[model samples]
Target: MTFPTIPPMHRDLDFNGPLSDERAARLIHSLGPLKGHHVVDLGCGWAELLLRTLATEPEATGFGIDLGEENIRHGRAGAEARGLADQVELEVGDAGAWKGEASDVVFNVGATHVWGGDPVVHTENALTALADLTRPGGRVLFGECFWKRPPTAEEITAMAVIPRDQYRPMPDLVDFALSHGFRLYSLSEATVDEWDTFENGNAWGLEDWIRDNPDSPDFDEVVRLTDAHRRLRLYGRDVLGFAYLTLLRV
Candidate 1:
């Protein structure tokens, strides 16, 4: 699965963006006994899932791959600082390639949706890659976003966001897995409280980011989107994203 061309995007302001290690733990609770296993965290932005796996599984090793070098650098540095240099490897590679030989379980905390808001076509390549790496009966954990219900015309027009059909619905992500020879394991819905909390708190480190790099090209866009998120969450919570966490097994 070749990763498609990525549009200009930035995770620099991701203070509360998407899934955290704390939240991911709850979603992946049933993965059970990672002893002597190999895991790949696809679209491993920041390497949260990989870092957590290495922390918990002393005998297991984890791999993190992403197209963004900045995210990879952060992941590598974190792993090194945690003394997980040996058990964790953060490489700059395409998530769509299943270069690794064997994997017991593969997971992505939150990168699934951002790569492509839709679950079927754009995300299929990532799923194929994960499945290829996993052993028979292996699991794939996808932590992504989706609507609580279909989008309303007014909602999209107001937010200036993509339409619901443009993104794969939550139910479709599961169907995509099954069609690819994978079976459903579990699906965890991120609550309204969860979405609101993360969406609102993403401004945590943004002020410092601005002070440090005010002249950067993406600085303004980052600020703009962040501000937009704050307003939308506070005022328009029901119209947009109600993300979730789900897992599948090959």
Candidate 2:
């Protein structure tokens, strides 16, 4: 199903994830000293994390790669506005194929599709790629969804858009990280409020877009997406959870 184009205002927002700016800042702070280091962000939507890292670590430089043209454009503008144009580079490209410069930190948030469409393959491949790009003792922060509770078969069927095997329990994810030769430094899970904010924000944006473009040909698509977002929020809120895991390369 075709999704509605995100509103321009939404594109200007610094973040497009479940975590709020405060939570994102906390995660950045947890990365230890970034000063004088080089960082890479794969699938860096709008480069929120990259920009934040640059702002926090004035001596650090960063590269952000994303497939979305608008995200790249907005991220570049944001870097310039923050006087970080010299310190950061934003490129429009596939994160999977972009073997980033060997850097101190590598971040991939909510874009596991780089590895492949299959969720299990995507997670494993992404972890491997992140580890390869990070220098020894460097850090990789990966964000993904997991099962919050034991989902019933009916619930799993309802969320069939995502492969059932892809959503592992939290312990299994930790084990997967350990098996990949990385130490789990820390992890931050999104709160229910954060999830609600993300979902409602998307629905609100679509509602505004639909209202403003009532005669547009994409009206039906927008409506469909708006409905789907609401349903997912209502039904999956209890079963689905998101987390940002900080893995230290061994």
Candidate 3:
């Protein structure tokens, strides 16, 4: 199906860091055998994880859904380049509402807004939605941000632009999963270095684009993204933390 082209400014503004290739590999490997299984990735940017998993598990078939047509285009190309286009499908759609057959493994990384704008509701609804998409005993991997430590009122105020309520301490997340009847199979937190790499990678991409298209009208917007990236890097390093939790339906 055809999807609307994302505006340059909107695309630049949505530049959140993604998991590194190495980390994606590790996370995929941790999900156990995938041969002949069906996998789905909601909000699958570039479909890196989905495509990587398909490459390793030759017999597996999968779908990668995201709202960005550009991302889906790139992802479709990546799958074809890997000779996986026949097995993996990439589409531009809403991750929250795209219904498919029950999958063996489902993933939603750093895109909780698919469920709702509120973090708490996002966490709850996203989990429920993923569970609905998974077959009995299937696994799900959810990546989200959390408060690294208690933040002072001023610190919270400084980061007020972000929805603070969406993040809770690590313990609360684990407890939430347990309450939902999912067995926490594995949890991986991003190291300082990994976080740095992701954030810097986004900034570098924007910088490179700006350099290549100096005459483009979007230059100012790209510069604004760079400035915001700088603030996120400087202010969010210690306060914001990210983790990938692998949960099995019990």
**CA-only RMSD, every prediction:** 5.6, 1.9, 4.2
Task: Give the residue spans of candidate 1 off by over 4 A.
Answer: 1-17, 20-22, 113-120, 204-236, 239-248
Better of 1 and 3 by lDDT: 3
Clash-forming residue pairs, model 2 = none
Model 2 deviation from native, Cα RMSD in Å: 1.9
lDDT by residue for model 3 (153-175), tens: 66666565666677789999777
- What's the residue-level lDDT of 162 in candidate 1? 52
The lDDT ranking, best first, is: 2, 3, 1
How far residue 229's Cα lies from its native spot in candidate 1, in Å, is: 4.9
Q: TM-score for every candidate vs. truth?
A: 0.75, 0.92, 0.86
What is the per-residue lDDT of model 1 for residues 1-250, given as tens digits with 9 covering 90 to 100? 3332222233433322455446667655667678888888877777766677668878988888888787788778878888999998888877665366757888765565434535444566556655676788777776555666675666666555454454566777568667777777777666566665565455545655666777777777767866765655654467445344445564
Q: Pull out the clashing pairs in model 3.
A: none
Better of 2 and 3 by TM-score: 2
Give RMSD (Å) of candidate 3 vs. truth: 4.2
Model 1 residue 87 lDDT? Answer: 93
Per-residue CA lDDT of candidate 2, range 33-52, in tens? 98799989999988978898
On lDDT, the candidate that comes out on top is 2
Go through the candidates in order and give each one's C-alpha lDDT: 0.64, 0.82, 0.78
Q: By summed lDDT, which 10 consecutive residues of candidate 2 come out lowest?
A: 5-14
Worst 10 residues of 3 by lDDT: 1-10
